[model samples]
Target: MLKFTAEHEWLKLEDGVATVGITSHAAEQLGDLVFVELPEVGAELTKDGNAATVESVKAASDVYCPLDGEVAEINQAIVDDPSIVNSDPQGAGWFFKLKLKNASDANALLDEAAYKDLIA
Candidate 1:
């Protein structure tokens, strides 16, 4: 299972890390994005803080960090092709994965059901 932010960020848990990205709905809202600013690997991040950037044809938005930890990896392919965000926001569009400093951070986010309600 995954959690989501009201801001439309999705978080997937795997091996104690949270893989994070914008939702398909968010990509749809942003329209055609032109650029993406990915976090550097090994960068320490703060929960709910800025983690990355998405520059759409309409506007540029910051991707919020879903948990506190060091960024373990980032998807470079998506950086080269930002449209991957719109095409597969949940899978290949995932921006980065963070090695959680505190596993409890998951409790602070909205579960899938709650998130669906938020956008509904």
Candidate 2:
């Protein structure tokens, strides 16, 4: 399932893990990315906590954790070439995999329609 936060983070959940990334809207707003810093594997993250950093030609922004979890894996591709985020923020640009503290907590987040309304 896919869920989104008001902060513009998106999560794709399967089993107990969520792949997290900045939304396309966020990527567009940030412009072309120049750098990305991801959390260490095994780091515990709280909902809404800063989980990663992305710097663009325009500005730098925090990629917030949309739910409480431990970092299971980090995507090093985006760090190696941050522009990948601009090209595919919701796909190849994903920042990390999180092992959710409570998988059910994802149900409380926004759905696609609500997130579109929020960004509207």
> Which candidate number maximizes TM-score?
2
Q: Please give the TM-score that candidate 2 achieves against the real structure.
A: 0.97
Poorly placed runs, candidate 1 (over 4 Å): none
- Model 2 misplaced stretches (Cα beyond 4 Å): none
lDDT over C-alpha atoms for residue 25 of model 1: 84
Query: Clashes in model 2: which pairs?
Result: none
lDDT of 2 at 117: 100
lDDT by residue (1-120, candidate 1, tens digit) is 588888899989877888999998899899988999999999999977899999987788988887899999999999999989889999999999889999877888998888888888
TM-score of each: 0.95, 0.97
lDDT of each: 0.89, 0.93
**Reference-based lDDT, residue 97, model 1:** 89
**Residue pairs with clashing backbones, model 1:** none
Residue 71 in candidate 1 has what lDDT? Answer: 94
Q: For all the candidates, what are their Cα RMSDs to the real structure?
A: 0.9, 0.7
Q: Residue 35 in candidate 2 has what lDDT? A: 91
